[model samples]
Target: MASRSDAEAAANAATGRPRVAVFRPDDERLESAVSLLSDLGVEPVPDPMLAVEPTGETPRENADYVVLTSKTGAELAAEAGWEPGASTVCAIGPATSASMEAVGYAVDLVPDEYTSSGLVETLESEADLDGASVEVARSDHGSPVLLDGLSAAGADVHETVLYRLVRPPESGDAVDLAASGDLDAACFTSSLTVEHFFEAATERGTTDAVAVGLDRAVVGAIGEPTRETLTAFGIDADVVASEATFDALARETVAAVDR
Candidate 1:
């Protein structure tokens, strides 16, 4: 009898080309997904399951600090024409910090790790959050980790929900490929994207199919948060990027498939 790994190896040898599904919203990261998979000599399947719409609300005045967790939030908030004034700006990652800087806002701090928990740890140790007013800009679907953490540290946290993430009419081609067991791997960038992907699979009556497909496919997660989300759905990530960046995730995905 052939072992599971042996079967997978035989399948890969038969196909000659690995098919990797890019599971995320259509945004700046899409280009990286396509290009990275191509560079690894894999077939790239673009599966955009979510869309972000900016909210029109402006940032509040008298904030002591401004917190941005994602580049999308930073971009949308900047487009809304809100000034950060003399408030210290904090970004979750370098990408978000760059976005904030591009809009003429000086970033005062960035977490060593690009995560909500990392942000909380950095702020708790470095800044005096007691009774300070902190403004957070992000999507409605964003996790409450940052807000809850800041609030627990005695900061009066205000939220400027800059965008709402909405599901598309249908799961893209990648979901179908995943359901049919035709995909060699799939990369999930965010927890929301992982949630929406399964929801779409259920709606299309491909839940079982996807479950079976995932057993044979290399699952790649962008970070610890996304990997945790995948685990919640009974799927284990075979590869998790060291950094929470698209390029890192793509490289990890290719490495996972190659292994």
Candidate 2:
């Protein structure tokens, strides 16, 4: 008469093996997850779901500040000959700060909370942004939250699109793996991965899409935004990892499933 929770806990405890679903798109994280999961007696399934594309648009006009939300976005900027020399720079997290620093840009600030909301909160409290022209280096989607917040705070904010989130050519393979139930589950590190991969599946067929999406592979959302995307797709995630990072996803995967 064990409840579902008790059954899952017992299953995990008795087996002492974690069947983990790694969703990072075959990058270094995939290797790391595979290594860590193997060391921990967990099976790591590396299935990449999204691709990041950069739009090599030069800055239309210079600004006093530039903010980068993703390490990839900052790297894209560096690739596009965009380097912050005198202007102050803001990054969303430690990974992003390292990326910017690698390109020789000194990160003026990184929010403690590591979200757009937290970034805005930090600007409101710590920055003297009055009359400062700010530029945001970003991908194709999301609101103008950073710009809007800076503008509302009396800063002149400008936006520069640096990248786009697209489906990788091999995303279909990942989808097929999920449909076949070999994936067990997939982790959504970002909303873009959810949008592009699901759109790719729907393009193939809705029934197959649902088969791939159903509880077949427990969905692991990394944060609130990713969770929102999964819910929008009519899939209630089995777990939303503690933080918006891959390490959190990997750890949560190990905790939730049994081998």
* 12 Cα displacement, candidate 2 (Å): 19
Question: What lDDT does each candidate get?
Answer: 0.82, 0.69
Best by TM-score: 1
Measured against the true structure, the TM-scores of the candidates, in listed sequence, are 0.90, 0.80
Relative to the unseen true structure, what is the C-alpha lDDT of residue 197 in candidate 1, on a scale of 0 to 100?
87
Q: Candidate 1, which segments miss by more than 4 Å at Cα?
A: 1-15
For residues 235-259, what per-residue lDDT tens digits would candidate 2 score against the true structure?
Answer: 7888888766677776676566653
**TM accuracy, model 1:** 0.90
Q: Model 2 off-target regions past 4 Å?
A: 1-19, 33-40, 59-62, 206-213
Give lDDT tens digits, candidate 1, residues 204-258.
Answer: 8998898889879999998888999999988999999998887788888888898
